[model samples]
Target: MAHQSTHETVDARRIEVIAPNFKRRLSGVTTTIVQLVPAQRADGLEIAALGPGLPRHLPKLRYRDLWRLRRPPQARAQRVWHARRNTEMVGGLVLRDVLRMPLKLVFTSASQRHHQPFSRWLISRMDYVVSTSRKTAGYLERPSTVILHGIDLARFRPPGEKFAAKRAVGLDPNRKIVGCFGRVRRQKGTDLFVSALVEPLRANPDWIAIVAGRTTEKHTGYAAELRARIEGEGLSDRILFVGEHTDIERWYQALDLFIAPQRWEGFGLTPLEAMASGVPVIATNVGAFPELIIEGKTGIVLPDLEPSTMQEAASRLMKDDGMRAAMSSAALAHVAAHFSVAREVAELRAVYDAVSPPAETRAGNAP
Candidate 1:
């Protein structure tokens, strides 16, 4: 896709919303901004993203575009500056308070842990705050609207046949495949997932597991250790580690079961993504997994990080074909009803409307 030039004739007056992601790395915050920007625009809101690492196709405001905030965007009393990170929040505060720009600062808190003094101060300055889950909201000192992360349902729906999806991904169609996807690290509990599946995978000849994701430089030793353990058990063929894939949705579609064994997380979305792809998840009780997973309905949630705990849950779910099928249907329905991207966009728009100027003055001044 061709990128919009920095000098392109984008009407600054039309930009009612500015979503800033200063971080270069593609974290969950970056992912949220990338998904929501287009959806917000589709809802007739003139939203644009600002910062590095975002896709070229999305509407963006260049660094030089900061000047535009001095004059309120057309059809809005003040442009909403949406920040997802502490640095982004600082940037927004600088624009609004330091530069005296006519901007409304909005920060979305995703971390479930207690904030430091610096973070608390930054968050307190926001005109409005959004929390990704109820658990996340508990950490906030101020009032925050809980808005759970939603997935692009159209992009992550079920494949016609699970085996066909496996074949397309170059896997044996006959064997039942389970997957553990995300950053391969100790914190993500990649080791926990592997350890738990070992006994069950060794026992069941028809079943195999795949670990799909990248292990960064810091976690190279940890990834090698996990691989070494798998090799030592002579289960290399049964357990495979395929590196990150650009088209992760297709991989999710191929899985008979998905595991998210994170030791900790801040509103992790892997379980939601798995459910959206019509796969039942077996996730650890971290982040918002307890709330996202409907226990026996959508998938099983482990109370602790024990390999035995996960093994028992996985074995039961895997053996019961009828129950797995029921969970699959329930998973899809649950995501569609509660976690659609459209719903997230609507909820966020309502928050923006609440902080923005009235319709009369906003519309009356628009050229």
Candidate 2:
């Protein structure tokens, strides 16, 4: 019932997880809801091919279920058949087999891109299509649904003391902290964050920054380049690299501000989490940032994602305690109202009921 549920539960409703990375925040929260559907009931499988060795807490669906359900096969025939078969299977199992059962199909991000053909095919058949961002939802012409991923306020709640996080993370608590957490990749705009944000904040001795997450992939070299830039700018002492850590919320609490200078994002879950933790967020105005943030109210959004503009916004937030406090309070209130798990789940369930065939009272003969 709690959207922040960590344990596994099952039921009769057929809920599928089409997200590729089950361990990621969106997939994790989506799966948490799927778990509550009741037992012996085969809901939809969340097909995230994010490789093996997932977290133990994540439930395991049959391999066939995952492989069969994943969007748009490279082969044309296979993709069509897959969607059709999925539709028929869900329709039969939920509508014909169990009269009162419900069926819900959800997918996110790049998965929508990969499976567009299959997605369009399944759209008319699906009870609900959940898009993580309105931009993503716009890609779908059909009547669809949206649930920007919800953060677990229970875990990501504001820390009792902000300084404790800085101390715990080996940062100087005396310095004003501006931090970014999440995978360091081109799409995430790590380069932009450093150039746009970190460089501008360099003028203030009180401002320090930490970029945390694995920088060892193809992006490792890029990370190296960023480090080199920091050194070149004489900011070695100011910027710290805190690689990947399991306890990320601790990192959230450590910061005076949270910065996400991404080029584009899909309903960025982190900002919501940061807001829930009562940290003021300064993010690029791309994807769902406009939807999640209330400009100067909940958080500040960069009008132009350029480095100069970004740096200016970051500098403004860093310098103004009154504005930061107002934004922080507003951020928490915004999350509680719009991004709360209960609100999202309730909306999703309504979609499920509306789309469920038996639940549909539209008379076939009605004019």
Name the top lDDT candidate. 1
Model 1 lDDT on a 0 to 1 scale: 0.90
Q: What is the lDDT of residue 120 in candidate 1?
A: 97
Score candidate 2 by lDDT.
0.62
**Residues 1-367 of candidate 1: C-alpha lDDT, one tens digit per residue:** 9974742245677899999889889898888888899998888888888888887777888788678679987677789999999999999989998999999999998898999999999999999999998999999999999989888999999999887999999999999988999999999999999999888887778999999999899999999999899999999999999899989998998899999999999989899999999999999988999889999899998889999999998888777888889999999999999999999999999899889964675677689
Q: For model 1, which pairs clash?
A: none
RMSD of each: 2.5, 8.4
* lDDT scores in order: 0.90, 0.62
- Candidate 2 least-lDDT 10 residues: 75-84
Q: Candidate 2, residue 295: CA error in Å?
A: 0.5
TM-score, one value per model: 0.95, 0.73
- Runs in model 2 deviating more than 4 A are 1-53, 63-119, 122-125, 357-367
**Residue by residue across 1-367, what tens digits does model 2's lDDT show?**
6466432422211223222232333333344334332211223222222223344444444334533333322211111111112333344334323543222434333223434566466555554456666676777756555667566677788878878877887888788788888788877888777887555565677888888877656677878888899889888877778888878888888888898888876456778878988999988887688888888897888887688888788878888999999999999888987876656556654443354322123444257
